[model samples]
Target: MGHDTVETPNLSFGRGATPDRSTPYARYVRLDELHSLQHPRSKEPAELSFIVTTQVMELLFDLLRHEWTIARQALREDDLPAALAALRRGTHAQDVLVDSWDLLATMTPQEFNSFRSLFGEASGFQSAAFLHLEFLLGNKNAALLAMYDGMPGTQAGLTEALRAPSLYDEALALLARRGLLPPQEASEQRYRPSEEVAAAWRRVYTEPESATLRPLGEALLDVAERVTRWRQRHLSAVKRTMGGKPGSGGSSGLTWLRKSAEQDVFPELWTIRDGL
Candidate 1:
C-alpha cells in the first residue's frame, strides 16, 4: 500500500493572512536551527549535557544584556519605574543562570575529563556575549578587547559597548542629577570604587523614606550580588571538576576565576553598608 501525502491547511488567527502550522512557530523561533546548534565534539554522553548547558548560558547572557540596555535607556529618560522593571527582570534571568550550574555540577570529574580535551582552545573566557555583559555592568578592560581582533562583528559590538556609558554610569548620572552624588570628573574609563560613590549610597540608605533612589539602589544591589554569586559558583564548579590545573583554553583557571569572583560588581553598594 502506498501512503499519500497531503498538505496541511493553514491555521490563521485574527488579522492578515493565515500562517500554516509548519511555518509559523518554527519560522519565528527557528527551533530546528536552535536545536541543531549543539554539536558536541566528544562521543561521551556527558558532553551533550555540557554543551547544552553552555549554549543555554550563552542565550541567557544575551538576554541579560538586552534587559540591562533597556534599563540604561530608561534611566537616561528619567523613567525610574521602567528602569527598575528591567533590572528586576534581569534578576530573574540571573536566577536561572545561577541555577544552570546544577546541570554541570552533576558531571563527575571522570565524566568531564572524558571530553575536556575535545574542547581544544575553547573556553568560557572567550565568550564575547559575556564580555559585553560585563562591560555593560561597568567592568571594562582595553586589553580584553584584543581577544576579538580579527572578528570585526564582535570587535565592533565590543567597541561600542566600551565607549557607551555603562548601566552603572547612567545610574551615577541619575544620582548626580538628583543631588545625591557629588560632582566628579566624567570619564569613560573602567569603573573603580571610590569613597565619594560610597558616600552617595550612604545618603540613599540613611533616609530611605524620602529618597526616590532607595529602591533603585536596592535593585542594583540585588543584581550585583546575583552576578557575584554566579562567579563564585563558577569557581566552585571549576574547583570541583579540575582542581588547580590549567584550563583547556590557556586560561589561569581557578586562580583567575577566584580573583574575578572576589571583585564586587557595585563596590559602593556593599561598602556603604559598613557605614550604615
Candidate 2:
C-alpha cells in the first residue's frame, strides 16, 4: 500500500508577513491609530487643527524627554561623544517643537474664541510632560508638582524626576570629574552659574583644542540655545493666543510663561558666552 503524503502551509515568522522595507508603493506607521486620535470637541474646522497641533507638540515633548534622558546618562558617564550625539538629537527635536508653535500662531482671537470655552481650565499649564522637561533641565519648583496631586501617576513621575539630577547638573559634574571645575562639595552651594564653571567654559571656548573638551562644551551650548528658543516661541504663542488672560492653571498666563522662559537651561554656558 502506498503511504499518504501530507504538506503543511509555509508560514514566515518574524516581523510579520510584511517585509521590513518601504517603497512608493507600500508604507507602514500605524496611521490608523495616529489619525484616529484627533477628536475635536467642536465641529469647527479650526478645532481640528488646534487639536492636531497640540497633539503633535505633546509627541515632540516626549521625544525631547527621551533625548534628554540619554544625554543626561551619557554626561553622567563622562562620555562626551555619546553626550554630544544625544544633545544634537535633542536640538533637532527642539527645532521641530519650536516650529509647532507656528501652526497655532495663525489662530486669531476669533478662531480660538470658538473653542476656547470648550477647553475650560484645561491648558498647557497643566501639562505634566512639559513640567517634567523643565525639572530635568534644572527648573524645578515644588509648586509645579502640586498641580499633579490629583493624578497619582503624574505626581509620582514628576516627583521622581524632580529629585533626579538635572541635565545641567550632570554636565557640571562631568566638568568637575574632568578637573575643569572646582570640587563638587565646594560647588554644591550654587551648582548653577558658578563663577568657576563659567571661567572653565570660557577656557574651553577660547582654547578650541583643550583636550577634546570644546566639543562637549559647544554641544551643551547648543542644547541651551535650543531650549531658550523653545521657551521664546512658547511665550510668543501664549501672547498671541490669550494676551493677558490668566492661565487655565490659575497663574498669570503670559507673564508667568515669560518668567519661566527667562530661567536659563544652562546658566554658565550663556554666562561664558558673553566673556568669550
Candidate 3:
C-alpha cells in the first residue's frame, strides 16, 4: 500500500487567506458604524482628532455605566465576587478614560478656537452617557435632567437612572445583608452621606479578617479614586484649551469644571479612610 502526502490548508491570517469581512468580529463590533461617527464640523486637521477622541470618551462612559450596572446587580444578588470583579473592571475602564485626555491635552487655545465656534451650544455637559454614568455613581441631580428636556428618549433614560438605586446604594445593601450595618433606604433622590455608612466603611477598613466587605470597600474606593483622577485630568485639559471662557453649552467652562471636580464619588469611602 502506498501513502500519498496531503498538503495542509494555509490558514495564515492577513496573508495567505483574504480576511473575511463577514466574520463575527466585524459584525459584532460594527466597525463601519463606529468609524463613521467621527464627523468633524471644521476643515481644521485637528478637528478630526477632537471629534474622534470625544467619541472615544463617550463610548468609555457607556462601558463604565454597563460595568456599574453589572456590579450593582451582582451586589443585589449577594454575589460579592462578581460585584468586585465588575467594579475592578470599571476601574480599569476609568483609567483608560483618564488617559484618553492625553489625546487632547496639548491642544492650544488657538487650535481649539479654530473649531470651537462651530459647535455652538454643544458641550460635554450635554453628554447623555456621562450624565447616566454620574447617576449610576450616586450623583443624582434632577436639575441636570432638565438639560435633556427636548430629547424625549434620552431624558426618559436619564430619569429612569435617576430613580434607580445607585452603585453605592447596592454596596450598602449588601453590607447590611451581611450584618455590617442597617440596610440603606433605596431612594431616587440625590445621595447624601450618612454617618452610619461612614462608620460601616471604617469598620471594614479597621477589620481585615472579620469584615467581609473589606475587599469590596477597597474596590469601591478604587473606582472613586479613578473617577476623581479623570475629573481632574478633564478639568486640566479644559483649562489648557479654553482658559476661563464660557463653555460651548453656556457653562462657565473652567469654573464649572473646577466645581464639578470637587465632587467626591463615594464620599463616605474617603471620609472613612481619613479616620482609619
Q: What does candidate 3 score on TM?
A: 0.88
Total residue pair clashes for candidate 1: 0
Which regions of candidate 1 deviate over 4 angstroms? 1-23, 184-188, 208-210
Worst 10 residues of 2 by lDDT: 183-192
Best-fitting candidate, scored by TM-score: 1
lDDT of each residue in 1-276, candidate 3, tens digit only = 499889975566874677555668878998777778788888888888899888889989999989999999999998999999999988889999999999998888888999998988899889999999988988888898888789999999999999999999999888787777897887877789989988877777777654777888889889988888998998999888888888889988888788889988889988876667
* Model 3 segments more than 4 A misplaced: 1-25
The residue-by-residue lDDT of candidate 1 on 92-209, one tens digit each, is 9999999999998878889899889888889999999999998998898878889899899999999899888889988988888888886654455779999888888888888755
Indicate the residue-level lDDT of 107 in model 1.
81
User: Which is superior by TM-score, 2 or 3?
Assistant: 3
Q: Model 3, residue 46: what's the lDDT?
A: 84
Steric clash pairs (candidate 2)? none
Error of 1 at 220 (Å): 0.2
Q: Mind giving the per-residue lDDT tens digits that candidate 2 earns over 1-276?
A: 599878964555566566444443444566656778987887667888888888888888899899889989998887788889988988888888888888888888778888888978888878888888888877777767778778999899988888788887887787777777775532212235668878877776776556578777778778778888888998998788779888876889888879878877678777776656
- Of candidates 3 and 2, the better by lDDT: 3
